[model samples]
Target chain A: SAVISQKPSRDICQRGTSLTIQCQVDSQVTMMFWYRQQPGQSLTLIATANQGSEATYESGFVIDKFPISRPNLTFSTLTVSNMSPEDSSIYLCSVGGSRYEQYFGPGTRLTVT
Target chain B: GQQVMQIPQYQHVQEGEDFTTYCNSSTTLSNIQWYKQRPGGHPVFLIQLVKSGEVKKQKRLTFQFGEAKKNSSLHITATQTTDVGTYFCAGEDTGGFKTIFGAGTRLFVKA
Candidate 1:
């Protein structure tokens, strides 16, 4: 099991402002992903943070809105740009292990005001 | 686009009773994973089923993968207060490009 940690467990920010969430894993992982989970809803994939290349985003998300940076295998960041009330959600960092199971960070709860 | 549908959005069960959640995917999956998220917590990996028609057990929990690899189920025997949480089923497409997460079934256990 990997120990995953995310910065700013919870935060409140003004609309139009951006918030960058950081995720650190205890060990190196091949797959790192960012997810957005709305209140009382399921997890939605934001993007796949590749180690050295551009993140692969999902259908409803784009790099402009959620810029991701994966500097190395054990660390990554997700920045929510130009946030709005609708963007308020819990952002989570996940790492996939050799078994294909995922380990998740505690998640950053962002509330756009 | 692929979609994974989960049923029983919410369930209320008495302690010591049984509970189950089902998931079906629009596309065939290479594997299915189960996760549990306690209230105000992150989802924790519970188990994964890779083979078709696979059944795996962990303590009081039983998980099943459909023979077609397009659906799955999780059953808990004698639910306890500790079992109260949202259970999610995630399916990985055959291409392994992405994973589709189900809507999740929130379990409420009354003591």
Candidate 2:
């Protein structure tokens, strides 16, 4: 099991403002992913942050909107650029554990007004 | 792209009643994982099924993987108030790093 933490647990941002969420894992992990959960909706994968190199984003998400930086094995950052009211959701960072199980952070709740 | 679909978007069950959620995939999966997210909480991993036709039990919860690896189910026997949450099934494809999650089934328990 891994202990994962996310900074700025809850925040309210105005439109057009960007919020960068940081994820720190207690131990080194090979795979890290960013997910978004809208109000009354399911989890949507934004991108997969690799230890090095570029992150792999999902089809509906783009790097220009959600840029991810994984500088090391135990840390990563996801920046929501030019945020809109639609971007208001809970952003979660998860690490793949043994046997394909994923341990998730407490998640950063963002409300854009 | 792989897609996973879950049935019964919402369920209302009385306390002590049983509840079940089904997950179907468009593609065969290497493994399927179950997660539970309480209201206003993040998702917590429950278990993962890797073998075909495998069934695992944890307390009152039972998870089953289909022989085709394209479907799975989670059944909770004698649910409690703590069982109220959204259940998600995530399927991982062979040789793929991405895991696709189902839309999830929200369980509402009335005590």
Candidate 3:
């Protein structure tokens, strides 16, 4: 199991601004991902953070809106660019387990107004 | 696109009562996993079912995978206040790493 931590537990951001969330894992992992969850909704995969390369984003999500950077196997950052009210949600960092089960971080709650 | 459908989006039960959540996938799955998320908390991995018709138990929690590998369920016997949370099931397609997550079922327990 991997221990993951995210920064800025909760933040209230103004619209049109941007916020960068950080994720750090205790152990090296092959797969790291970013997810979004609206209030009382299911999780939606945002992107896969690939170390030393561009992130693989899911459909409906783009790099211009959510740019991700993974410097190493255990660290990654996600930037929510040009935030809007619709961007208000919980951003989670996760690492894949040996059997594909995912371990999640505490998540960074962003409230864009 | 793959989808995992969950039933009874919300359930309210009294303490000591039983609770159950079910998930069905449109495609065959190689494995299914369950997770629990408390209010204002992140999702925590609970268990994973790999083989068809698999049944696993952890204390008061019981998980079952359908023979078709396209469905699963999680049942809690004598539910407690601690069981109050959202339960989500994720299904991974055969030979694919991409997982489809269910909408989740929120269990509310009254003490």
Candidate 4:
């Protein structure tokens, strides 16, 4: 398993504003992903943050709304653009550690008012 | 996309009693991993099952993978108060590192 640290454990933002969350892994990893979990709901994949390239957005998710950046193997960022009340949720970052093992960060709780 | 379905959305059990949660997938999986998330905390890895009909134990908890590799279960014997939280099952498909997480079963252990 890998140790991941996410910044701004939580934040309160106004609607129409933007917030950027950062994820840093203790060690180098091959793949890093971003996921969203609404209150009392299951986790949903937002995008795959790839190093030195554009992120891969999942179906029903767009890059314009959630821009992701992976500058290196151990760091990545996800920016929620034009926040809305519906966008208020827990944002999580996960990294593929070893054979089929995924490790997650503590998560960032975002509240859009 | 693969889907992992978890059953008994919520479970309430008395301490020292037993509890179980089941996970079924639409497609066969190469491996399935279990995670436990305490209230207000992130999901933590518990164990991973790789072979068909495989059973692994961690103290009072037992995990099993179906013979078809499309289902799995987690059984806790003598449940404790510390067991209160959500249990999730994540599956890793063959030849893919992408993991699909189940909705999870919330467990409530009462004294």
Candidate 5:
């Protein structure tokens, strides 16, 4: 299994500002993804981070809002540009492991005032 | 896009009781996985089912994949306070590697 880590466990930002969350994996992985979870809600896939390529975002999400960068198999980043109160959520990074099991990072909780 | 639905969004059980959560997918899933997330914690993989009509057990936990590959279930026997968490089921679609997560079932174990 893979061990994933995220930076800035929790942060408070002002509206219109931005926050970049980092994800690191202990081992190389072919699939890396970003997700968001609102309070008392389920996880929502944000985008897929592909090494050396642009991220594939899910519907209702755009690069201008959440730009992703994957320099290699072991690291990735997601930036919440122009933050707003609605953008406040817990951002999680995940990597596919052996079989269908996937490991997730500790998650970065962002609160935009 | 594929979607997964989980039943009984919220469940409360006394310690030592049993609890179960069901997940249904709109399309045939190539693989199904279960994850557990404690309060204020990230999701951690619990198990995965790839074969149809498969059943696997881990201590007090039991996981099942339906014959149609469109549904799955997670059962926890003799639930404890430590078992209080949210359970999510994710499905891998046929063509792409896109993984979709279910709404999740929140379990509360009252000691």
Candidate 6:
């Protein structure tokens, strides 16, 4: 089991502004992922943050919009750039756990107005 | 791109009733995992099923992986108010660590 935490548990931002969410894990992990959950919607994988390389984003996501930085094994940051009202959702950081299960952070709820 | 489909997006049941959510994947999965998320909360891992035709029991919750490894289900017996949340099923692709999540089934238990 891994202890994960995210900064800025909840934040309200104005349109066109960017917010960087940080994820810290208790131990070193090889695989880390970022997810987004819209209101009353399911979780969607935004990108996979690798320890020493560029992040692999999903189909609907682009690096210009959501830039990710993974400097080390236990830390990563996701920046939501040029935010809009549609970007209001819960952003989660998860680490791959034993037996293929992923442990999630408390989540950072973002509201773009 | 792999996709996992979950049925009955929303369920409402009285306390002590049984509830189940089904998940199906377009491609064969290496493993399946279940998660529960309360309102305004992040998802918490419940259990993982690796082998085909595997069934795991965690108290009142039972998780099953299909024989074909492309489907899974989570059944809760004698549901309670504590079970009011969204249940998600995630599948990992074969030979890869990427996981795809289902739309989730929101369970509403009336006490």
Please state the CAPRI-style docking class of candidate 5.
high
What TM-score does chain B alone reach in each candidate, compared with the true chain B?
A: 0.98, 0.98, 0.98, 0.97, 0.98, 0.98
User: Which digits, one per residue and each the tens of the lDDT, describe model 5 over residues B13-107?
Assistant: 99999999999999999999999999999999999999999999999999999999999999999999999999999999887888899999999
Q: For each candidate, what is the lDDT?
A: 0.96, 0.95, 0.95, 0.92, 0.94, 0.95
Provide the global lDDT of candidate 4 against the true structure: 0.92
List model 4 lDDT by residue over A4-55, tens digit each.
Answer: 9999899999999999999999999989999998877777889889999999
Tens-digit per-residue lDDT, A3-113, candidate 2: 999999999999999999999999999989999999788889999998779999989999999999999999999999999999999999999897799999999999999
Q: Please provide, for model 1 over B1-111, each residue's C-alpha lDDT reduced to its tens digit, 9 standing for 90 to 100.
A: 889999999999999999999999999999999999999999999999999999999999999999999999999999999999999999999977688899999999999
**Best candidate per DockQ, number?**
6
Model 5 chain B: lowest-lDDT 10 consecutive positions: B92-101
Prediction 4 TM-score vs. true: 0.97
TM-score, per-candidate, Cα-based: 0.98, 0.97, 0.98, 0.97, 0.98, 0.97
Q: What TM-score number comes out for model 6?
A: 0.97
Residues A1-113, candidate 3: write the lDDT tens digits.
89999998999999999999999999999899999999999999999999988999999999999999998999999999999999999999999999969999999999999
Per-residue C-alpha lDDT of model 1 across residues A52-73, encoded as one tens digit per residue: 8999998889999999999999
Each candidate's number of clashing pairs is 0, 0, 0, 0, 0, 0
lDDT of 3 at B67: 98
RMSD of each: 0.7, 0.9, 0.8, 1.1, 0.9, 1.1
What are the candidates' individual DockQ scores?
0.91, 0.89, 0.83, 0.73, 0.88, 0.92
- Across residues B35-63, which tens digit of lDDT does each residue of candidate 4 receive? 89889998888889999999999999999
- In angstroms, give how far residue B58 of model 6 lies from its true place: 0.6
